[model samples]
Target chain A: MSLFGRQSKRDLHSLAAPYALDALEPHERARFEKHLRTCDRCTAEVRALSEDAVRLAWSTAAPAPLAMRDRVLAAVRNTPQEASPLGAAPPRPHHLPAHVWGTEPPPPRRRAPRMRPLFAPLATATAAAALVVASLFAVQATRTQDQLDTARAQSREIANILAAPDARATNERDARGRGIGVIASAKEGRAIVTLSGLGDLPSGRVHQLWLMRPDVQPRSLGLFQGDTPLVTSGMNDDATSLAVTVEPNGGSAQPTSQPIAQLALKSVGFGE
Target chain B: MEADELLVRVAGGDQKAFEELYGLVSGPVFGLVRRVVRDPAQSEEVAQEVLLELWRSAGRFDPGRGSALSWILTLAHRRAVDRVRSARAATEREQREGMRAHHPAFDQVAEEVEAGLEREWVRHCLERLTSLQRQSVTLAYYDGYTYREVAEQLSLPLGTVKTRMRDGLTRLRECLGGVA
Candidate 1:
């Protein structure tokens, strides 16, 4: 579907050029990105268009000021290079379908002819068991590695957002005067909610964050547990306030209880 | 070494390769940033950030995707556009209205930058596109206007601008492919 409505395949394909040129709006760009992952034709078209755009970019080549060379080179000297290529690859989707690990049992292996030595079958059985155990360990290791990579990438994104010149934070208090801190960047469309001074919730309940905009329905940002800061992105640009509510675990489609804390967001100059 | 090879070495902490890569890309990066950012000082600053990011994220460069030049330029453009948008967003309403009135002058500056044989060829290709297509592509790519802004500027519908840009770029790509 198009960002605003259903789009025909041709309409989606037409987005490749604008997408490559970085001309689409944020929401439209996002929708086209989702479409790009599954559409080979559009993907190839975008790649080709991007290469052309680079040429177009090069056509505007005015010499950079001579002073920049020394500064950049000096900075490079002071910086340490990456130790590995772990986070270089785009994060692969980690979810695996349940059916991938087929439910049916393998057919029993046919018995070797009577002439075959008994020890051979016994050795094969032992090797098979060993292989199965090894494979299981390998899968577990890979899953752990994927999770580590994801966490590392996320931490990097959070750090960048926090470092943004426009990043702003506000401390909010509930009716009971508990603190909830919020850090947000409107340009980046990201926010981090930090729960502080709020005691642990009882079982079967969670804290859900909502973005309230003038004349717009409150939209759920996310649900979180524990006191750690939760990072959220793709926030509505017009949201003027943030709120937290107690909801049933797994989060409600809509708020079911009064907000525990609320904070009005003040616009801060970003990218200064 | 090629840009990709230099990037790999840079990833492995080769300062020499990093310096060489900087020499290769810094001009185009600065130029691209200047197109979108307008202010030379701010463009230079943004270019520095983009180059620094390239050094820091060299290991993440996936050669299988595209050439190193395209990737770096893409990043430069993104940073430049972000700077422009954020700066505009911060200005008061009257100031933004004033900016909208004068935004078309930026396109003239873009046109004036086209020099040399290579640029002349590009200009030729660009001119070959219909006026609407040219305006849409130039405003979006060079002036850093979003499709919505382009539509609004041209007094055309959003869908019309999208189609024009796509068709325009497709033709430009085909033309450049032949020349390259």
Candidate 2:
């Protein structure tokens, strides 16, 4: 979805720097981050900028109070380390020059052909160039049209989530980097769920989505593949959370494997 | 010991490594949190929470992904920023803070942290950014203002502020001599 939940990739790319700075509002941050998973260039750029931000933090080196360290370490001694076996994030490529995406590349240099003496030839060449440009633009327009059509189609249900007076978006990621982002309207009893970094599963294994309620069984919202966002209803005023699990193809009546990821749906709202 | 390696060891339940990591990073973590959170009690509280999180979540640190220092500072910064974002009526007063957040606020932060070599280096590089870019980076990073709030404070368009932050940080990295 764009900034208001209609995602335009160009606008989302510009958010990398702000995202690194922790400068975005919650819903916007969730949206950009959901975009970040599939975006390799932005990932590299964020890592590089994050390195710079870390340097900015290095100067504030006031020593911790003597008693504070003991408190923390004591807590640490009692706290068991998480058993999460997720490996480190894959290495990021080198950051590209800043503003590679911000400023448009310099217009391609046009070679000045010397057709000065032949007016007829110049006219012919001009027509051919115009035709080429038109066809190229037509191809681009078609692609944009297809994307717009998809956006419009999904907007019907998603807009219910984004436009709700109490629309709220939340995002959660596992240590493995698979994440889920949801925008839901409490009043409308509707939600839009988006998944990221969950790549294709092996044959016969599919990703399942469930609406976990307090008293009832985790209801199946249906299975998801690829990167499409899902819209589910039946959210009541309760502490509901979304969970995703891997199950055999078709679907499982219940989540078999431990949830690969889960996000609690707390007071979902996007008022800001 | 290398910071990430120590974190990995801590992940493996190495108590010694956890202690060693604390001695190394605790100051920087506390300082960064204090810089943003401002209040001593809350800053210490947030810092303690972040360090404890460092212990419990150490298993998630991937050496291949990034430096341990960067990862920990990120955790600290986010927690600090979130603390302020919720506690303060920032949006209501952000417009008023605009004029005050410019050179004076930037100067105070730069001067406060001037004791370290990296602080001096960062101050020098921050000087290279154009005015808007500098405001965009400093207000968000130091003052714990959201970019939207930064936009309100600086009276710049949101898009403009976002780009300035990216461009400003990019320039800072360049001045600091490119990505390592």
Candidate 3:
């Protein structure tokens, strides 16, 4: 009855049981994984189980309401960009004031502290202090220049995206078109949907998307906001209908009533 | 352009690209948080925080590690878990316990009523497990319950609960064909 020993089927199952739930003690799981490489049967079992767990996880994943999407995207828009950890350092700006720029200069290539006769000690210390000030300015200027260049390049890239042809398409949401806009797109897998011109919802309300197909009832694609777009799954041409509605802030089991605006999508297009 | 490409533009400081990337990742990011956090209001709050974090940190994303989707999901998961854990710590157990009392076990439900792209794969894989194994696995992963907690809830021995969870995951991995 004890399947705690060796490579027998029962023992393997017993060991794999915890691995399935991710409940294994770390050492035990590691040992089982080691044995799994050589044992095809165990490997197969583990794979099957993990997939089941993924399904369970998937079932529970409901789309977050539209307001949340707007909030997050809006946040992303405002968030500052950080320098690449791997990219080359930005060139130092030559014109910036030394005080405003880079790291302080190395302390006048400090000479080792020397014991001097007491009388001239003040003079020696003053000289050393003066030297440090001069070096600090030089180092500060160089670092400041580097930071300036990085900021300048980043700003230019941003300028280009704004100037791009599609920039207007995304930024200005159309009211006449029933608040329709394409936020972002991929050829095969997904796209971001945007809307505007729709009146704002009350505090607890959020917009939602439904992917309508002939074969099934409209599926709750996810939530969105009039101010920002949403990324919904299953956007192919087969996805005949796209509709929006106000649901409870996080969205609902289904569209409670008619959509605020319903648009038919012929095909899922790649982002322009 | 790809959504990730737009995100790269956003990182460069393009407002349009930032807007575009927002459209693409926002749903999953939001949905993921909502699933974990449960409260619509709180979920939205967490979602807003995650998005802002994503925008601020877009420059940090490296395509090498994984897709943009994964990057966003990782952020959402971390934030949601953080929110839940923090709230759990701040509130009494009884209050939080009342909040989670009515949730249904995913396995007991038939198939996902909505046939999304991944639904079939998800259903097939989940169906492969024995009922007990499936239940234990779902409670731990999706519900965010620990194995010991699951054991207590189901009135099963701790070791037995652990075994079922492991076996359940193993079966799922195989059924899904492989991990991403």
lDDT of residue A69 for candidate 3:
44
lDDT by candidate, in order shown = 0.66, 0.68, 0.52
- lDDT comparing candidate 3 with the true structure: 0.52
Model 2 global lDDT (CA atoms, 0 to 1): 0.68
| TM-score of candidate 2 relative to the true fold | 0.54
lDDT of 2 by residue, A1-272 (tens): 34755456778888999988988887997787777779899889888998888888887788898756655554453334445332222222122111111011112211100111111111111111111122222222334556646544655665344445455444556668687766666677787676766887889998899887778888888787545556678766564788899999999999889988887776353221
Off by over 4 Å in 1: A1-11, A81-272, B92-109
Which of candidates 2 and 3 reaches a greater lDDT? Answer: 2
**Isolated chain B TM-score per model:** 0.89, 0.86, 0.69
Name the docking class for model 1: acceptable
**Candidate order (DockQ):** 2, 1, 3
Which portions of model 3 show Cα errors greater than 4 Å?
Answer: A1-63, A82-272, B1-15, B59-62, B89-91, B94-117, B156-163, B178-180
- Residue A181 local lDDT, model 2: 64
lDDT of 2 by residue, B1-180 (tens): 989889989988887799999999999999999898787866776677678667756766777768899989988888788876655654336547673342223333455834666777788888889988998998999888888878888888989998899999999888888423
* Backbone clashes under 3 angstroms, per model: 2, 10, 40
Is candidate 1 or 2 superior in TM-score?
1
| lDDT tens readout by residue for model 1, B31-87 | 889888887757776777677667756767778878888888887886777767666
